[model samples]
Target: MPKLQNIIVLRTFAIIAVVLYHCYCPWLEAWNWYKCEYRSLYSFIFETVLVGRMPLFVCVSGYLFSHLYLDRGKYHEFGNFLQNKIKRLLVPCMLFTGLMCLILQLNYVENIVGYGFHLWFLKMLFFCFMTTWLCAKYIHQIKLDIIAICISIIMMFISMPKFLGIGQYFKYYYRRDSRDNGDDAR
Candidate 1:
């Protein structure tokens, strides 16, 4: 398969896993499926499938980023590439956030704050792209592939409570109300 095709497959799988995990977690909790008498083997399937779903998505993202930005030729294409990326990332983010906010106002959803949560991923992606670009431009001679991976790992780790307190703050303040329930809460 072509590289682009591979990326697409990976991206699709990651997205599906995330959606399934999110959807399943609620069902699992709402029905107390885990505690069901004579729990079926499907319970094991659900537990295994949804476990670490977000990390799989993150790994796929990292893989795609490596494929895109690690090469010298791609670095030369940075201007158009970055512009396209910003448009692709930011436009949908803005549109979705606006639509969700409107839905909340119309009482289609309970929390406007929660609907705005999807923007967090886009916002973080924007910042990551910008930071990577800056590092590539000004910090030439530094091996950016290693740097990118390191930075990505660091960012991911910092967003965890075990390391930096920043992650905890982000979880509390920036997380959406829809995710406020402990099961789906990031």
Candidate 2:
């Protein structure tokens, strides 16, 4: 398969934006909250990037997911897909989160559910993949694009509790954005 240069570039920019957002997040206020030294222009900058930083990343990811897995609007090789996602996303998330918790002397149990460092994105991505798998498997009546849109709209209202890394869903509804045009190359 040919490499997607534009996606590579967009993903690079999204990663940089996410890194900068996190670097300055300590100074921004969240929905529930965060400890800010004092509100400053960082808050404005943080909020500005916050709106689209992860969404940009998700858009690229969705594009890639479609390109890789959804051939002719059908997902194939379920077992292989699940295993690859586990190996590529879940395992790394666990190891890095665990390592960071140990090194930082933080509680593993407290941090593992998508809160240890920036590794939460990995866990959230895993959940997004799992959600796609589920939708592709069971929701055969409706079109995936329509389901994605519905899920996105539903997610905007409900704040699911954090458990088994699911709070990461409500924390950021990237799963709701699985139909981005990242696969325009196809």
lDDT of each: 0.51, 0.67
Worst window of 10 by summed lDDT in candidate 2: 177-186
Question: TM-scores across all candidates?
Answer: 0.56, 0.74
Model 2 off-target regions past 4 Å? 27-39, 71-75, 137-142, 170-186
lDDT by residue (tens digit), candidate 1, 42-161? 446655755554545555664566566665246446778678766987667667766866764543223222333444455455554565567666676557666656655555434343
lDDT by residue for model 2 (78-137), tens = 778888888998888788888977886878888775354567667777777777677767
Candidate 1, poorest ten consecutive residues by summed lDDT? 161-170
Off by over 4 Å in 1: 4-9, 28-48, 75-79, 106-115, 140-186
| RMSD of candidates 1 onward, in order | 7.3, 7.0
TM-score of 1: 0.56
Model 1 CA lDDT for position 31? 30
